[model samples]
Target chain A: MNRTTELHPFSVPRYPSGNPAQRVIVQVLVTQDAGQQRHAQLLARADTELRHLALPQYADEAALGEALATLLSEARVGVHLELHGDEAFIWSLCGVARAAGLLGDEITLQCNESGRRMLFCVHCASLQAGTCADLQPCRQCGVMLEVRRHFSERLGAYLGVCADADQPYAQARP
Target chain B: MSALDARVGETRLITPVIREVSLMPVNGTLPAFSAGSHVQLHLPNGKRNAYSLLSDPGDTSHYRIAVRQQAQSRGGSRYVHEQLQTGDQLKISSPANLFPLHSTARLHVLIAAGIGITPFLAYCTELLRRGAAFELHYAYRAGLSDAYVEVLREQLGEHLHLYESSARRLDLGQLLGHRPLGTHVYACGPQSLLDALREQSLALGWPAARVHWEAFAAPEPGVPFVVELARSGRQVAVGAEQSLLEALESAGVELPNLCRGGVCGQCRTPYLKGDVEHRDLFLAHEERASSLMPCVSRGCGSPILLDI
Candidate 1:
């Protein structure tokens, strides 16, 4: 029996919600059509300052990444970051924020498109996003992987281990 | 904690109230300690006092600690100042870090008042070694409790900010306002300084975790009381001069403890009955209802029953 002791990102609300006491709150929209603009607007208050940055459609995330790095470097101690996008986009930026000295508590993720989860393959050390299925093939190494409930905030992905010990990796074609 | 026998290599009088002592291990090099580590020196007068390690943490060749002779010297600091000389043998507990540096902070702001600069001495070395961004705000009177001002000036250079007198007091409002994100502030000093730092940090919207402190305030003398062990049904009388932990130790009751000044939550004991005068900085107000830190906290008026 598999005990669901580890926390899945789904266990919390779509947007875990930014802290109201935060001195500055920056919400980044990875996709303009994620339909979280209304939800992001509701977070604004008189006391705390809230700013929004949107990623244009089909644009390179490199610019957004650069902007985020600059913003985080200049940000003060009481700043909180909110990311509104798909699981992959949110977690990817979470990595960027963590690299820039932002803690897990300082960042809130609101996955506009849920049900699909990001998994980190242990065999190949690659990340893949797929349906919320227990078993999925590793996209990089072609190994059958089992998604574990263990979530890594640093990696921003669920742990994926080899589903079958006998066949660690898929057979190569002739 | 097991004691390590050490010989006093050197001693220097920093001020009328402060004495700096260096201890060399009798057998081998001492264990390496971190930034905010301290050790309990079992005094010649049978009293133990915890002093922060001031020397470089990585250098275990010898351990240096500064002792501030308290006005009400329980014979611990008094013995060190009056009798303890070079070549004297002493037993000191291994270094324990109750106060530690925040691992992931982008910028570290250290605020020290008087002899409280001891821990930050190690912190400055460690932070510089890591090549991390940091600033040290030291509030001390010139030639009074200013132990290593010259050395710190050479070391910190631009990062060190000193407040010499009441005329140039530390501005908490300006100090805590508008810092880069992922900044962590550490304050070590008297209770009043720590209290003000907490209040100002909270008012400035700083998270509780972002603001750390180590209070050097030792337990004040309190009213005498008796501690009744629940299991053994043995009663131990504590005197006004002795701390509850010291009394318990004298009674041969083995209790795990560190930082006996009451910041470390190692000696937290569940109580079944009696009112307690909680003097510890560790426990919350609600937790004080069921448990008490015996290191500094004490039983009041009635016989306190301990879960043991």
Candidate 2:
């Protein structure tokens, strides 16, 4: 339906607009209470052919991982993905999408939580999730981490290393 | 870093279509670089092209690159193949790496198609020196193309596998199956190859962190659009093959630019109007609300109004 012309998959102004695919497969991932209403709304927007996969409201980081794996394996390539949830949940979805090799241009990441986000580590790089306050906790072999920036494109998690070693605590500060 | 003078040391025909061009800096030694580093050469036609360094990054004696002559000679490759000679002095940008190897991957899986094997040449060197666990799987048309097969086989030995013609179809499911927890895959080849690898890696549940790729060619040249300069009120037509940055330059308008490929953020310009198709990775998502990287980004509906 010439959908590509109106909204470039990964481009900004993502929707100047286009027609929804007939029998289009839309995946709606719901994670938090605040995102439930939007999740329902997104479901209404999709056609009956839309494939649905839902994570429990209290789904933790691991559940998000499993959900993403299902999405990558089950979601038809070139189909649209609608992520309805909090920043952490959204990041989790993004991390999974990335691991499954979905490019930012390939899917739509709709974050329900607009507030500043704090990412949960999968503990893949280091099994340490988000318990520490500083970017660097003398815990990981003298390595300092910058909590907010340097997101891993593939993992969808923010890379927690101090981007600049000289200024180790930049993320901790305002 | 600014460009320095280099002479074409030696050039050889690596394959039916690929030419190996060796470059040596006129002054002292060239700067040391990492495995996936590439250097840009300024051609006499005023066009610049970046090529991955195929020589050992440790020995800066001279840098080597494999250039494949495309159906469309953008003048850059043609200049190197046709006019450039052993004694010809050329200006080359310092080596820069947008595709650096990950320092933490436990097991590395390298995949390539045709000339996509260029960057991995240097990577094999460093990986071997560090005694890293790695394997390279290559695919090519049976008799059509295979750039550095001999060299890779000799160095990689049993570690390298080549799939010719009908078997060239990569079974990514099997390749990415049961990957160790920290295994990482790097693919540089045709967009189709990268897409397949990425899809299978993701489907098999590989962490996005470990699926690395570098495009064999530049980003797709987008649809034709227009740019209206606010200062002079001049209109410039940007062709599909041309970027906003090039169109403005052709119109005698100049903006700061470094790696014309959009790695360097120097060409960003404030925009006053029109929907921008931001194609670059340089600017943050929010930054695009007010500005754009002219080198890669373009206008969608109407002519983009630039503050320039």
TM-score of chain A of each: 0.69, 0.51
Please give, for every candidate in the order listed, the TM-score of chain B alone compared with the true chain B: 0.96, 0.86
lDDT of each: 0.81, 0.68
lDDT at B234, model 1: 93
User: How many residue-pair clashes does candidate 1 contain?
Assistant: 2
Interface RMSD after interface superposition, model 1: 2.8
Poorest 10 consecutive residues by lDDT, candidate 2 chain B? B201-210
Worst 10 residues of 1 chain B by lDDT: B201-210
* Per-residue error (Å), model 1, residue B92: 0.9
Candidate 1 to truth, TM: 0.89
lDDT of 2 by residue, A1-174 (tens): 124324433422132122223233344444444455655666685343344455653356577678667756654333445555544555566667656644454445555334334433322255333432434442444345555433443444444554466655344645
Q: lDDT, candidate 1, residue B56? A: 91
Tell me the spans in candidate 2 whose CA falls farther than 4 Å from its real position: A1-174, B219-228, B231-242, B247-259, B262-266, B274-291, B297-302
| DockQ of predicted candidate 1 | 0.46
